[model samples]
Target: MKKNKTLSEMTEEELVGEFTNASIAQKEASEKDKFSKYNKLFDRIVEIRNERKIRPGDRRRDLLPLLTHDNIQVRLMAAIETLAVAPDAACRTLKEIKDSNWFPFAMDASSTLSWFESGRFRPE
Candidate 1:
């Protein structure tokens, strides 16, 4: 089953699909199991994003569009994924989310902004 694939085994499209579904699930339901799945998938996606950052090419372009997706979680995760390699654009995305005033997302964006200020979001 597709769900059996390890994080390293997932293609970029597959990763995006899981992230999008997780975002949808988080939005449509408040169940603990549902949110737990989203949280796990989000952590996996972030891990892969960070790993890819250490590679030699520009990959942030692929995630940039997701920053503006209709799903709040998708947008938030995309902002986190892009923060290191595309600081200016990611910061702008975070600002937009923060200004949108959706409390949860704004709070996440605000914390991410603090990471930016502290240089914790990017590798030295």
Candidate 2:
């Protein structure tokens, strides 16, 4: 039989330490599972995308393609994530889509970009 551990039984540092020796692939798979499991718990993907530990250049490249994802929420998250790293690089793409006929979806992206530029919302 497996012994269950309470959340309080493990400190954050202890939890991190347990995974410290994991291979990169193992760590990524775990993170993906966690992200999918808690996707609705706020913008977790965006948070991951903004993590300093992620290679900024690689993230920037990945985010560009996500901007065109079929899911509007994914696209919005990509826009936010891209802006967090390279606001100027994302500005042109965002401006092109801001006036799209997608109603509130496009509007929301535009609003988020505006807020980011005005410093109303700081990423990380």
Number of the predicted model whose lDDT against the real structure is largest: 1
- In the predicted model 1, the residue pairs found to clash are none
TM-score of each: 0.71, 0.49
Tens-digit per-residue lDDT, 9-71, candidate 1: 766666567666766666554335566665666666666666556655766667787877988
- lDDT for model 1, on a 0 to 1 scale? 0.72
lDDT of 2: 0.52
> What are the RMSD figures for all models against the true structure?
3.4, 10.7
lDDT of each: 0.72, 0.52
Model 2 lDDT per residue over 1-124, tens place: 5365432354434322222212223334434676544333343333343342344234344456655555554555556656767677666556656767575557866887788889998865
Q: Candidate 1, residue 118: CA error in Å?
A: 3.5
The list of candidate 2 runs beyond 4 A from truth reads 1-47, 50-61
